[model samples]
Structures are given as C-alpha cells and as structure tokens.
Target: MSSVDIPRTYGALLIGALFASILSGAVAVQSLIYQKMYPRDPRSIKLLVFLIWSLDTFHTGLIWGSLWKHFITDYGFSAEIDHIPWTLALSIVFTAVLTFSVHCFFANRIYMLSKRSWILTIPIVLLAVLRLISAAGTTVEMMILQSFSNFRHEVRWLFTLGLALSSGVDILITVSLFYLLQSSRTEGGRFNGVIDSLILYTFETGSITSAATVVSMICWIVAPTNLIFMGLHFVISKLYANSLLVTLNTRKNLRNRNRSVSGSGSPNNNQALILEARRAQGQNSATDSAFHVKSTEV
Candidate 1:
C-alpha cells in the first residue's frame, strides 16, 4: 500500500516458510515411523497418513513458490507487494483441505469414543465442513481480486469466519475428548494411571492444535496488514499432521503398559482390563478381545 515494508512482507514470509519446511520434515519422519511401527493399521488409516503427508509436502512447496515469486521473480517492483501470487492463493485451499481432513478424523474418533453418538459429533463435523467452505471461498476471492488490500477490504470476513470456525472446532473437539476421557476413569481407580496418561495425551494434542489456530486468528485480526498471520497459518497444517501421528504412534506403548498391569488375571478381571484398555485407546467395542488393541482410525 503506502510502502513495501520488506521486513514485515518478505521477511515474515521467509521466516514462516522456513519453520513450515522444518515442521514438514518432522511430518515426514513421523509418517515413516508410523508406517513401520503399525503395519497392521487399517488400509483407510494408512491412506490417510499418506494423504496428509502428501498435502503437507505440497503445501510446503507452494509456500516456497510464493516466496520466490515475491522476492525473486518480482524483485524491486514495490508495487508487486500488493499482488497475491497464485501459489499463495492455492495454498489456502490445501491448508483448508488438510485441516478438514484432520478435523473429521478426530470427529470420527469422538464418535467412536462417545459410543456412536451423532448428536455430539454432528455439530463438529458441520462446523469443520463450513470452515473448509469458507477457506475455499476465501481462495476464490483472493484469486479474483489478486490484491492483498482489495481482498482485505472486500471479503476479509470470509477469511475471518474460516479462522473462527477452525478455532471453534478445535476447542470443541478438545473439550469433548477431555470430558469423555475424564469420565471413563475406572470406578476404583485401579487403572487410573493408564487413564490419566490417556487424558494427558488427549489434552496435550488438542491444546497444541487449538492454540495454534487461536494464535493465528488473533494475528489475522490484530495485524492483518502484515504477513504475520499468513506465516502462522503455514504451520497450522503441520501441527495437525504431527498431532495425529503422535496419537497413533503412542498407542502401542500405552496398550503394552495396560497389558503388563493386568497380566494373567482372572477371566472377569481380564475382561474388565480389556474394556479399560479399549476405552483408554479412545474406543468402545464390546467384542474386542483382551490382546486386541483397538485402532484409533475413524
């Protein structure tokens, strides 16, 4: 607008892209570990990991392209600072897609943990879907306007709505999971240790993603003139990817601990332990055997 603030415009972009790439590397490492550690996971789950990783990788590439366009291709052209590159515009769609996938994945987990309760899960899914739609609309408007100032002035509400929905969904998911896990603690606190571990894990994962979304939303609202918000937005998808992988990868250890705690018990005790174990894994299935570890995939 008034002047090309290289620090806030390009420098913020460079820093954000660097962090996003580093996190993408973490995603790749975690994805490979998940594949190696849990080969028995369902086909759909495997496919989901692959899809999220692919999207993350592609999103990283798009970010670099946008950076290149701004700093290299259009260097010294101060007026070009206002124009939104196609790569950046499209990255919004990918971010939305990644967020939507992760949200739905968790929603399905909540459904399973809540004993197939649609009443609790439906609102979350609908909010996530609306978030995705809002992102798509933002992307379309960005492309059509092709100018940061124009987009901000005309359709800023669309982007704002999308961010708000993302935060709402994240907070809702975290609270639902925390409440469910807290309520599932055994009557006598025999397996309180295991349930406590699960509750801690759920709270940590949800908090990480929700905090990132909330911070990004605040940046978007308070400093929309700069690229700081977009920088944080770049990392949100990576957080979601890593959170899911961490959740899946830790299941084996937790299941083993549950087994060790309840080893060689009487038939009734063994059955109770199995139910507790499944519940700790965020699942509820009456038919699950003692040794069978329930998959976290929706």
Candidate 2:
C-alpha cells in the first residue's frame, strides 16, 4: 500500500468543506433575495427554494461530520481512515438528490420554452434519473464495501457515469434554451438585447455546473487513490444549488425589463437607441470614406 500523505488526503477535504460553506452562504443570500424580489412566486417554487437551502445546510453538516470522524474521532488510529463514514455516505445521497432536483427544474423550463416538446425534455429527464440511480448505487456500494479502495475497484464506473450524465444533461439544457431564445429574437432588434442577456445567463449557468462535474470526474479517474476527487465532489451539489438560485432570482429583473418595455407603449427610448447606433455607424462610414479619399490622392 502506498503511504498516505495526511496533508494531501485530508487537506483536500478541508478545503472542499470550506468552499461548500462559502457557496452555502451564497445560496442563503440568493434565497432571501428571491423571496423579497418575488414574493408572489408560485408556492411550489417557494417550497423548492426552501428545500434546496435546507438540503444544502444539511449537506454542509455532513461534510463536517465526516471530517470530524477522520480528524478528531480517530485521532490516533490511521487504519480507520480507509473506512467510509456514514455521514459521508449520506452526503453522497444528498448531493444526488440536490443535483436531481436542479436538473428537473431546468428540464421543465426547457420543456416550456420549447413549446411543450416532450421529445426534447424526456431524454434530459431520463438521463437525470439515471444519474440519480447511479449515485444511489454508489452510496449503497460505499456502505457495503466500507472502504474507498474497494469502492473504487468495484464500482468506479458508476460514479463516472453519474458525472458524465450530469454534464451531458446540463449541456442539453443550455443548448435547448439558447436555441429557443435565439429563435425568439425580434428582427426589429428591440428585444435582441434581452434575448442576448438570456443566452449569456443560460451559457453561464450551464458552464459552472458542467465544469465542476467534469473536473470532479477527471480527479476521480486520474487520482483515485487520493481524496481530492471526493473533495471536488462535495462542491458539485453546492454549485448546482447556487446555479438554480441565481437563475430563479434573475428572472424578476429580466421580466421587469420586458414589462417596462411593453408598458411604456412608446418607441421613443428604442428609437433613441436606434438613432445612437446609426450615428456610430455613420461616423465609421465617414472615417472609411475619408481614408479611401486619402489613399486615392496618394
């Protein structure tokens, strides 16, 4: 057996717990902002927000508990480090649940935005469910095996598949939303800015979660002996939670902008914007014309 570097193995976990803690704070703040900004949001949505926050809080506690078991409880016994802690096993399940919830939420959005296209949303949902199942299987195996080395040898493929499915679902959702928003663009260029903003948000939200999943998968594959992969995995659920919260909170701002544009019933501001754009174009045209004149003279 390779000698375990306590700092590398355990320090990774400590750093991951710190990151999870910070992201959890962001989740709480975003949830508060969402409540204040959209008080009339559907009861279902409010409940979802509360549930995600609660799960995140509990997930943090579990990470800490696992840390305590490793560092404090088994202070003198290094052999116990190999065994999977109950808190850590449960944390994996919680992460799977959180990821599944967020995935479902985005899947529903894609369904609505795609005009109730079951064809598009069904595949994403299926993939998400499969990911959840994989995660559950991983937890069960972890408990039964009770050792990281054994779990890695027996069912590392399950964990890898879950991460791949998660990344795939996120990409699918982002592309679907981006395509829908792009197609909805106004030829008149009035709502193009709004559509562009939506596109950016879609890309950003998808990228964050996808990137984390991919990195975690890489760590698991490349360095199975270390806890770094497990550490990265700890942050994945937090990223998903914050991504959902940010997406939900920003809807109010986007909707209000759209409403203001509609309610004013006046094209003056739009016209001014158009005129300003034209002015810039005209200046560029004149500069080009002058350059050509000088070239001809020379």
Candidate 3:
C-alpha cells in the first residue's frame, strides 16, 4: 500500500489548534471589554456582540475536541483524520456561521453608513447568504464522502466556491467601507485622521480573511491530499470574530483620543467634540446614524 503521509500533517494541525486557542482567548477578553464599555449600545448591536462571542467559544471548543480525539486520544491510525473528522467538519460549519455573522454585521454597517441604499447593501447581503449556503453544502459533502480522495473527486468544486465567495464578500465590504468613510470625510482633516485609522484597521482585518481563504483554496487545488490548508483554515474564523470585537472595543479609546485632540485646539475639534459628546452620552444619539447605527437593517 502507498503511504498516505497523513501522519505528517498532524504536527501542522497541532500548531493550528494552538494558534486558534490563543486567538479565541483574545476574542473573549475583547468581548468583555466591549460589553463593559458599550452597554448602552442598541439591543440589536448588543445581541450581535454577544452572539459572535458565544459562537467563537463554541467553535474553539469543537476545535479542541477534534484535536484531542485525533491526536491525543487516537494516536495510532489517527492519521485518518487527515481525510475529515466530524469535529473538523463541524468546525467548518461553525466557521461558515461565524463568518456569516460578521459579514452580516459589516453589511448592516454599510447600509447605515451608506444611508440605507439597497443597491449598496443588497449585493453583500446576497453574497453572505450564498456563502453560508455554499459552506453548508461543503460541510455536508465532507460528511457524506468522509475521505479526502472522495471529497476531491466529488465535491471539491463546492469547497472552492464557498471559499471564493467568502473572500469576495470580505473584499467588497472592506473596499466599500473605506470608500464610504473616505467620501464622507469633511474638511480640516480631523475626521481624516480617524478615517485613516479606520481604513488601516479595515484593510488589516479584510485582507487577513481574504488572504487566508484564498490561500486555503489554492492549497486545496494544488495538493488536495495534504493538510497544508488546515493551518489557515483552523484560525480563519477566529480572525473574523476578533476583527469585529476589536473594532467595537476601540470606541472608548478612539473617543478619548478625539477628546484629547479637541482640547488641544484642533480646528475640527468642535465637530469632533460634538460626536464625542454624543458617544459619551450613549443614549439616543445620532452617532448611531452613520456606521454606528444600532439597527440590524441588513
């Protein structure tokens, strides 16, 4: 019999598992900070925040269980896990769900910031739903097939389509959000600085997810039998969860910094101060009208 070399990939999987654990812990801490700081956020926004964290916890638990069963519990012949294990499979579904959740959150942000233009929001909303469907299809395909060779022969296209859709959605959201912010910037460059930070932050998060998905697709196409893609796949969802949480938690610091800059007599300080005051009030402020709109409109 030809050697499958499946055992060789467990080391990579272990590394992935550990990396995911680290990211998950970071996400949890960020979620706590978000709750404490943004308690007055609209109920819809609060629910989204809580839901993302809860899903991240669940995904991490599934990853741990899968790794333990394959690597620690069933050492010998555990290499078969390279094909596809139930937990790993479920992790894929959880990732789809997690990715969809974040994508929807950003999509709604776009709707709000773009002033509720259906033309702008519809594409992302459709793509996100399609992504979830394709991802679910991929998961079901894996479950039914149960072997990498069979997966490769039968439903590899579904897997590729799902990842492609996911990458496309992230790219769209990132580009559109940056464009909207840049276009919405007023004179005096006060908000310009904030926009700059937002553009950078958006790029980092968007590119990471898009790159990981693209890389995974390439690896799957190039070497379907190897676990090379597993390295990226495991932590991909964590990146999504962390991206949103990080954005949410930074509001406090962003507000404080704006206040400090205002006190220093910046020309646009007046406008910044108004926005800062609104955010500080945390009540029914227009701060939510733009990207901060509390509704789940998308």
The TM-score leader among the candidates is 1
lDDT of 3 by residue, 186-271 (tens): 66744557567767888998999899899988987886677767767888999999988887777776667656654665453434
- 1-298, model 2: which lDDT tens digit per residue? 2556667988999999999889988998998997887665556777889999999999999999999999999887877777799899989889999999999988877765665789989999999999999889888999999998888888889889989999999999888887877776645755567667778988998999999999999999998877898889889999999988887776656656655655554544433111010011333432100000010110
The lowest-lDDT stretch of 10 consecutive residues in candidate 3 is 289-298
Q: Superpose all Cα atoms of candidate 3 onto the true structure and report the RMSD in Å to 1 decimal.
A: 4.4
- Provide the lDDT at 127 for model 1: 99
Write one digit per residue (lDDT tens) for candidate 1, span 228-281. 888888888999889877777777787787777667444454224242323222
Q: lDDT score of model 1?
A: 0.80
Candidate 1 ranges with C-alpha deviation above 4 Å: 264-298
Q: What is the TM-score of each candidate against the true structure?
A: 0.89, 0.86, 0.87
Those runs of model 3 whose alpha carbons end farther than 4 Å from true positions after fitting are: 1-3, 186-188, 262-282, 286-298
> Which pairs of residues have clashing backbones in candidate 2?
none
Give the Cα error of residue 173 in candidate 2, in Å.
0.8
Winning candidate number (lDDT) = 1
The residue pairs found clashing in candidate 3 are none
Q: In angstroms, give how far residue 241 of model 2 lies from its true place.
A: 0.7
The runs of at least 3 residues in candidate 2 whose Cα sits more than 4 Å from the true structure, single-residue gaps closed, are 1-3, 263-298
